[model samples]
Target: MAMGKVPGDSEGGDEVGFAEINITPLTDIFLVLLIIFMVTSSVIVQQAPSGGAQTGLKVNLPKGGATDVTARATDMSVAILSDGRFVLGGNIVTEDELKRAFNDAQQKDPDTIVIVQADEGVPHGTVVQVMELAKGAGLGQLAIGVREPQ
Candidate 1:
């Protein structure tokens, strides 16, 4: 038996045989694909629609008439949970922080609209406080976000 060639081999040569499979390139490709999938999945999760409960705040909004009030792109939403926690843009924030955010938004756009979504179980004082802060920030156009009874 020869050192590099098998007996009666068709390719007659003393060249070193490459019998091992080079999996390094395959592994690199797989890792790149995995990273792309992870980034795309995170972006999809953020853009997906939240059916109210998806936000994790669970604010039981009050029922009201189904008016044709279209939410504009410049509208800001503030949610008050039953547990007395404030949520602005899906982030839990303190009352002072919420006020500061409103003030900052108002400075950027004086006509900025704010919608307060307060749970039914939330205290009346908490709801009033949010409204007062929005108004105090010079956001003249304010609306209360409510659910229409089915």
Candidate 2:
């Protein structure tokens, strides 16, 4: 068999455009996947909620995984939900309002540790944001409340 001899070599468009690997299918699949990826990425990014209402539990997680059960949830803990709802010491606050609240909390107690308790449904990054806020407010340490793996 020759290289470009598919029924009609120079007559029809099929022979002229035909590739040995039939790249058209591959191209189509790649394009579809690209579109799917773009759409999915946007959706995933959009699903990250931003709000304020401290509902999640608060606890002083032991640093470096020590058996220090003496850690307590002082007045410096923010619990966030999947919908951006955050609760700071039983008080509801918006994401924007958290800064001032954290500042006040830090003032009251310089040794304050911001404990973050995010819902299991919340994205991992969202929880990080909560911790960052605590640090930004000049708190000593940020603690995330996590249940022992069962």
Candidate 3:
């Protein structure tokens, strides 16, 4: 049989090269993935509660517009949860541990600033008590954490 000719064919058809690429399926897959990603992202955004409070305990912090400042490496944080628990750098700590942490920080830098974040539900006296402990640990600088009123 001649090249490009059927078994009983007298005339041969024009030669055909490679077959055309089929992009429709690829395009469909890409579009489906894009839609899935878009839907998931939107759901995540919607499911997350706003107001910038992202902690294990719900803390309705007092709203105030204090001076906006960047946190320093030497700066320390003390959070007072609504349940009267103390959190240092996101970890729950006992009063003794809190005192030790402050002492360690003070040993490294005498002027270490202690930022106090107390929940609105927390009693004022407890916040003051933490501040007193920070002072006893030789920390000289102290700042309170408050969210900007919305």
Estimated TM-score per prediction? 0.54, 0.50, 0.55
Query: In candidate 3, how many clashes are counted?
Result: 0
> In lDDT terms, how accurate is model 3?
0.84
lDDT of each: 0.82, 0.73, 0.84
lDDT of 1 at 122: 94
Better by lDDT, candidate 3 or 1: 3
Segments of candidate 2 deviating more than 4 angstroms: 1-64, 68-73
lDDT of 3 by residue, 40-130 (tens): 7765553225656334434468996556655799999889999999999889999999999999999999978899999999999999999
- As for model 3, its CA RMSD to the true structure in angstroms is 15.8
lDDT: which candidate is best? 3
Determine the backbone clash count of candidate 2. 7
Model 2: per-residue Cα lDDT over 5-94, one tens digit each: 466456644434345566799999999999999987765453212455433434455668665334565546578877878987688888
- Which candidate number would show the highest TM-score if scored against the true structure? 3
Pairs of colliding residues, candidate 1: none
Best of the two (2, 3) by lDDT? 3
Better of 1 and 3 by TM-score: 3
Residue-level lDDT tens digits of model 1 in 14-122:
6565576778999999999999999877665542245433343234679965665577777789999999999988999998899899999898888888888999999
